[model samples]
Target: MKLAELAKELHITTDSFIKFIQDFDLELSECISTDFEVKEDFARFARENISFLKNYQKDLEQPKTVEDIAGNISQPADKVAEVIRKEKPAIYENGVYRSSVSSFGVDQKLGGDYNFVYNYFGKRMPLAKRDFIGYRDLFFYISKALDPFANENTTLTDWGIHRPAGIILYGPPGSGKIFWAHKIAQIIGYQFKEIKKYYLGTSFVDGNETSFNDFLLETMKQEKVVLFMDDFDNVMMERTATSSVNSCDEETKEIILHHIDRFEEEELLMVASANTLTGIDREILAPGRFDVVIPVFPPNVQERAEIILYYMTKDLSDEALLKQILEKNNADHLPFWNEISARMKVFSNTMLIDFTQSLKKRIRTQYLKDNSLDIDIKKHLQPALREASAKLTDEYFEQMSRFIKDISVNNYDDFATRIENLKQELQHYRIVEKPRQAIGFTHNSDSK
Candidate 1:
């Protein structure tokens, strides 16, 4: 059964259930598949412990403090505070330092025993074998958004819920916004069509000029199509009093807004890709327009490992030299890639693939020279790692910081864990600039 369905049966939000798993230190991999399938054993545990899970979720709903967490987990308040100091920032309110800090993160840091939660594990369910790696939370969220479309007997309409007319996928460059856009189309059985640059402007079509309006009218006539527009942030940016706005982009926004109301009725979904939602005009994001916002996060640590391994041995046979080297170094497994992946915090999917490509080439060269099975693979990986690490520039982090802040404000409840994890990962590169002291002024009291 799917984890979302299990959550629905338990009368709890999937976000809360995910939090429960994290708080108990339950192995997420063992309990849920990459496709968000709930292992039968974990499902049984949840059904039997429904009350316990509900009560835990109740505790999670309220803003918590160091004392609250310490009491709940039966640990010292100071220890909990220490853990929170490193993990998350505390919000002060009502005469207390409080925040929605993860009790699971705090407990793990305090060495709290959570083995009881794992007793339900009977046999490990293999990850729903997919070309994609992690981001199960994201997939589940998207599934929920498209539920009305998937279920023929869905009463979502009674609750005033309908399929979204538009979905805005926002993320940093190369985080795979376009990939998820295609995935969304695939899920709904819609034909994916890109709104090319020429389609957005007056272009010669069959020796006649056709504008964006003509393109929209013709697209709406189709049965089911997802009209994708990339670089949406650049086109739909907020127009300030003194800011220069593009006439073509303004026209594009106007055109989308004008025809957006009829999108759902016509079985057409318009999906736009943007680097960040911070700049999009508020009018364009209004309800019944393009309000369904989904974030495409860069792969987390575990995901990075999986992606690296996937690319490293992509098409190599068992007898292949690279395969032999990987097996010899035990680099074929996920754990072997963890340390390096940990260092590649906040790297995009494109960057990770580049890393694997670089590593593979270096390994091939070394093999050609040494002509040995054990060709000191680690020695070649260093340069490849350096090459990939170069892309982790200051500008990229700036973009991610904006993305994190935007998600925290708009979709915090749904993505709290990811927001927190990314914040922690970003801390490594966030250097505080100390003020420079004058060179000539040193106190000579000791010398005197």
Candidate 2:
């Protein structure tokens, strides 16, 4: 019989039965199949292992510790604690462990200010303020703007002592804009609320203007909120631009601009990201609407090396195997890593991450198929890396280069000053040797 049928017969959960079998280091071929044949030998084996199964079931029935729960689900303890706070609110408040069902809401609606705060910021992992990879100057500027004590030395009524209303981060897609947004919110200790296009649509109300305005008002009222809007240009494109189709109608665009004029509350910080600055409304890019507009470029050579090493070390859990791979391709230390990064100069951070994840999957599949851990990573991964590199064609680089040049020429003074300032800031910071942890939710964080 299948493991599900066996679990039914034994009056235990399939997970519990699987864990029992795994604890003994026994691999059952039919465990994952729902329609496997149950021979006499399999029945006899289960009968022989009945006592062990009973013990496991009893262990499952007992109260679980925080570590036990985390290990069982392969999640961090902080995530478990947050889920407990959500699922068993009274138990968490009482500081008591009780037998209760834990319902993880991965797709639950985020309605009001309170739900938005608890759902996003409350459950976020605690990361160091300096954990952001690059873009030191941009991060520093934004942090100062969000800081409550930024203008402590200046007079309160001074004209120069005004809080920034919002920030616009424009860059190539998959260039870590959203990641930086989340990290900014975490550093400022504010609840994050991301306003999507659907949230601004007419489905919620008879008119899209009402829906958009309501979202803005709800977000603005929160005492500590970082409102993020991804793809700013898509939502607030120039009404007169003729190149591409606009998602928002003229009335909707006018409503957005009206709200932008009124979005000067100190309690709320607005941050938006777009792939390019072209075709964006001039008014939205005006000084008061979005006080800061920064352009994020692809990673430089040093930053690329750091990113590659981070992903390579983070995904390859086997320390010995990782060391071997790093030493491969040449006698010099870390030559393999340096070589890979050099070859992947055109890769964005997101592309690097995807490539590493793909390589990890291939390695796992090979290991399982060969029934051996000994495999040549370089031999297998180099070809895959080349395939990934092929996606970054000459046309892609030309498009990106043209966009950068256009923005620079359009705002020459501001762009030149910002680029020079970034260069000076980067001189003070070196790439620290550390593995990058996966951001946001992971497989373990999802519901089973």
Candidate 3:
């Protein structure tokens, strides 16, 4: 079962359940899969410790301070403050820290004797059963955004929260912005249609000439359609004295602005995928236009593990040689994959897919040569790791840094934990000898 579903069964919010696990010194790995699947270990623990779980859930509902958490865990307030400092952008107002710091992810940094016992049990959930791996929080946020469309007559609409006419999914390249754009289409019951280069300017459609204006007008005539435009930032970039904005791009931006006002009435949603919002024109980003911006982050360590496992074992039977080899290395489970994934910090989704493809070929070659499953999985993995990590060039890092800056300004509150975790991962690369500030990660003190 998914964590949200498991939390529902326990009559508590998923956030509360997650906090319960973290507040105590419990191993989240044993309790949940990389995809947030509720392992039998966590399910049984919640069942057995129902009272403790409920009480903790109640406690999390209220605002918590360093003193409150220290008292709950029987630790010193000063020590708690030190721990809170470790969580970046620690919000403080009128004396107490923000809710973001409440369920402090000390992760054994602060030692205390917790009253609850955590039991480890059960196998990881099958990859096929998961709707998508990780990004549970992002998925939930998108669902809430679409709630106005789903329940047209509800208070969300009464509160003037209609479905967004346009949404901009911003992230570094290969972070899966296009994937989320399609997902938004699915959520809002719209047909997905890519806005191609031809659709933007002028091109032959069925051997006839068609302009961008005609393409958009035709789309609006249809009901419940999502028009996806990739690399949107390049086209909608702000006109400036120093920068030469493309005439075609400027015309495209003007065309979009002209037709966007009618999108909501026509049941059409435009989803644009951009590498960063830093260059997008402010006129396009105005309140009633493409203002709904979402960030598509690269896979975190745990998510990278799940994604690797998924791609490696995709469509393989239990009797397959590759499957047997993975089983031997425990690569079929998260723990085995975790070791490799930890080293792949800041790797993109495309890199993970490339790594799996290369590894599979190496494994197949070894099996063919020896006619045995006695393959050194890690030995085969090394070359693949090197090959994939080659793509982590200076350009990619600069783009990623720009994305981090954009999201930090736009969506920090929605993703504080993820932002902090990514920042920690990115710090590893900044240590390499290079030009000062080459990677563009700001010091925590300066950034916050």
Among the numbered candidates, top lDDT falls to 1
Q: In candidate 3, residue 127 scores what lDDT?
A: 71
As a whole number from 0 to 100, the lDDT of residue 60 in candidate 3 is 52
The superposed Cα distance between candidate 1 and the true structure at residue 296, in angstroms, equals: 2.2
The digit string of per-residue lDDT tens for model 1 on 170-281 reads 9888899988988888777889999998787688978999999999999999999999999999999989997778998899889988889899899999999998898799
lDDT at 125, model 2: 22
Error of 3 at 24 (Å): 10
Give the range where candidate 3 is weakest over 10 consecutive residues by summed lDDT.
99-108
lDDT (C-alpha) at residue 157 in model 3 = 47
TM-score for all models, in order of appearance? 0.78, 0.55, 0.80
Q: Per model, how many backbone clashes are there? A: 0, 1, 0
What's the true lDDT of residue 117 in model 1?
Answer: 68
Among all windows of ten consecutive residues in candidate 2, which has the lowest summed lDDT? Answer: 103-112
The alpha-carbon root-mean-square deviation between model 3 and the true structure, to one decimal in Å, is 7.6
**Model 3, range 242-359, lDDT digits (tens) per residue?**
8899888998999999988889899999999999898789999998899799889999998899899999988987798789998888787878888889999899999999999999
Task: Put down candidate 2 lDDT per residue, 1-448, tens digits, no spaces.
Answer: 5444666786666555544433332223322211223434445555666674565566555566556666655667677777655444435544434333221121121111223213322222211212544444344444445544233335246545555567777777777888878866776566788987777645545643456767777777777787898878777677664555455545556766677655655467788897777777787778867757766666755556656556655534445544454445341234455666665654677778777667766766876788655667777668668666665656656545554565566544433434333344333333577986678777865546
Q: State each model's CA lDDT, in order.
A: 0.80, 0.57, 0.78
Question: Which scores greater on lDDT, model 2 or model 3?
Answer: 3
TM-score of candidate 2 to 2 decimals: 0.55
